[model samples]
Target: MASEAAATGSTNTGILGWIERSGNKLPDPVFLFFWLIGILIVISVIASLAGWAVQHPTELTEAGEPVVIAATSLLAAENIQRLWVDMPTTFTHFHPLGYVLVVMLGAGVAERAGLFGTAMRAGVRNAPTALLTPIVVLVGMLGNLAADAAYVVLIPLAGIIFHAAGRHPIAGIAASFAGVSGGFSANLLPGQLDALLFGITEASVETVFGDWTANIAGNWYFIAAMTFVFLPVIWFVTDRMIEPRLGKWNAEAAGNAMAEEQGDRPLTDGERMGLRWAGLAVLFVIGLWLLFTFGPGTPLIDEEATPEARLTPFYRSLVAGFFLLFLLAGWAYGKAAGVINDHRDLVKMMAGAMEDLAYYLVLAFAAAHFVAMFAWSNLGLVLAVNGADFLSSSGLPAWALLAAIILVSGLLNLFVGSASAKWALLAPVLVPMLMLLGISPEMATAAYRVGDSATNIITPLMVYFPLILIFCQRWQKDFGLGSLAATMLPYSIGLMLVGLALTIGWVALDLPLGPGASVFQEIPGTVNPVAPAAAQ
Candidate 1:
């Protein structure tokens, strides 16, 4: 039945059709952002009636005022009046947005300077066929720390490198996609994401207990463990499952060849020389950072403080500072190499950068509205507290709770694709509830991260779902959303299992997530017996 449908092709009609047809057509992020907002508004209307009507039974009847006007006015009112008036105050309360933008500014320069593209090409350019699979996957996974840049650079590059090595390009795309989007949370080096999550966690925890802190490494150990676990699974799945099905490409495939001629011409002689200088510049910056982080009387690190202080605001700033450092190095390199002839060219690079982010912008806008609406309704908080109560009452083992959370997270991901948005909604309730159950905020956050990251590649709501469709179209000219989904289902299942296993193991081990972060024992007498609870 499936093959018959594939042969005639009615597969691209619904969600799958949306995925297949939209491949690289619209900017993804923008589209997702808007869609999420629209959905949130719909949900908000429903929630407002459900919540408000439940609270004020008499308001269900119309007074002298028109019913619609009265309901609309009432719904328009704010839950927290202070927060409603002080947009900047509430906005700043969600500090992750700033950190993300700050880092992107510097990253934007590195990419504009051709540093990232050059490095990727240099890394994968003449690699052996046997090692190509793992190398591509590893590179893709590591690329997550740099934000969404990997999708534009690595995915297509994998096809080129694989084709050059006399292998199927689809195999390359599959392998790289697995690493970048699939293994997004599995970075060995903690990046801006860690800091962002920690900030949210810290804030959420504080709402429950008077004083609480979440560490930068809140999800580190779990992510690191997944790094090793993902490598072999990606390799085997790409080689055995995806590649064999793809066979070889035809003349149509030649059109999508990954060539540097269109972007910036292969690094010029001057650029190579500039790279040497840039390399030295990077070293200098690293030396300075080390001195500040460890040297006596250095402001970057507070010498009198404990390990957590050494990492908190200091490391957070350091992560943002990386973007600036990269930008500086790239600008110097571009100037030295003569690639950046003038300010106009530099602006063009950044402009071109914006073109790629069109989709992301769309997704963000919708996602922002969706998240805002979701928060406005207060359903997430209510549901989380209720769920936590049930879980806590069940007397289930921690491992079982962790597994259940992972499963629910993966399932929820199918509907809501934005990681930060989902977590923001989840954290305020789950974190604190779990904390009361002897699960640290760090552990709960870690479990949530694993579940969230594991299923991203399979979920059509993922902004880049369309991008993966484009990748599939190269080999299977008939490839659409269903094709992409079918191809990725195995990897999703594999990663889900691996992610859950690692999470369970971590809970069992009771390891520290990062400095001063732990898996067990929330502060005693933390929960308010009257109120359900806030998240960790």
Candidate 2:
């Protein structure tokens, strides 16, 4: 293993091994949030005593001077009272909670109905040997729409497909894993993650710009572009760096990777019919949305609003749109596939989806309190002000500041695995601070996605890392955790660099992040603070 890792110019015995060890020592993410809240209370009390404050950017006095904003003690009578009284509201009103649950209600149906699985099989079923790597990577990226389907279905199947094609099974597994986990955030269309992250972004935005509501698809265009940027990187790493180092697979030596009956079968006639039905369902949903947008009422299109504001309604509707799209398509597919018999069965699938979110609900409870308390203490705003001031004074170019955010998110991803949990902790500080420094919430969220996705493959702490390792060991009994990490390291490093460059270039070009979403947000009270690229 050491020789193989050395040959590939990767390492798992030193800093990376230490990272894996230390990361495991951390508490459960749920308990970690609770601990953070306890720590936040202490910080709030001290900051209040020290008179930590900043001038409110929007709030002003009768004379038109900026109001001096100060930190409030979480232990104060009013704050403690609100905490106890508002506990229910705090948990219930956590924005990401509803967004995630609703999306999953529909998605779970799709995954169970076999739509996601069959779609993946169809995509890579007949790929030519020459284009197999890119095809696998692309399918892996698209398979992210199903969340678990990519990891559980497509990745292992890639190994079989490779073996049958007379290629190294591990290389196929590596490429698929890279595309699925390493390119976690890159997708052609906004899905559950978009709803979850942007919901949190909206919540974070309220602390700084109270009137600014985030569109669920706020980072749509940017993430779509990431799909292209990452596809090639995963392809390059898998073919050039990873495959060259992995010796040929020995079919005789490798144990059966899966049960004899478990190898991917050609889609059944019923499944193919289900797929056709699902396709029709998707088209119907898209057409319905188009009609709603362009028809006489133009409910989704605001005629009275500014050009940039016109599509806000359409963007917001995407949450519901995704729900209906997945629900109807899954139901259609299930009906044809004989997986669902009646409306009662449909209801069961939705319930099953909610059942899957049980852990997320617990995590959201801890995160909600942390976010709410951070806002109530006034520290969220104060930190943003102070951080923005320091960042501004540092004279780091705006593009560089955005790049720094990507690096911070990527580094933190090594220890914290849940995307929402990390973003919940980060968005409060990173989003508001960057917004105060004249970066858009869209841009900040986009940068976080890039960084968060790139490092997922190398980290052992990622929830799926062990599962992936198990998959690899099925083919090669000697495959260990370090071997898996070493296999993915090149993909991690390559994606990070490409994603960083993409982010920097996006900011430098001042491109729109999504519908009406720009790289810079103009604060009402001040000139745009983003420093020019050449000025750096």
- The TM-score measured for candidate 2 stands at 0.94
Specify the highest-TM-score model's number. Answer: 2
TM-score of each: 0.76, 0.94
The digit string of per-residue lDDT tens for model 1 on 321-410 reads: 576577667777778877678877766765665566555444444444434444555544444444555776788999888788888988
lDDT at 55, model 1: 19
Ten contiguous residues with the weakest lDDT in model 1: 65-74
The positional error of residue 9 in candidate 1, measured at the CA in angstroms, is 8.0
Q: How does model 1 score by TM-score?
A: 0.76
Cα lDDT of model 2 overall?
0.86
Clashes of each: 21, 0
State which candidate has the highest lDDT. 2
lDDT score, candidate 2, position 253: 58
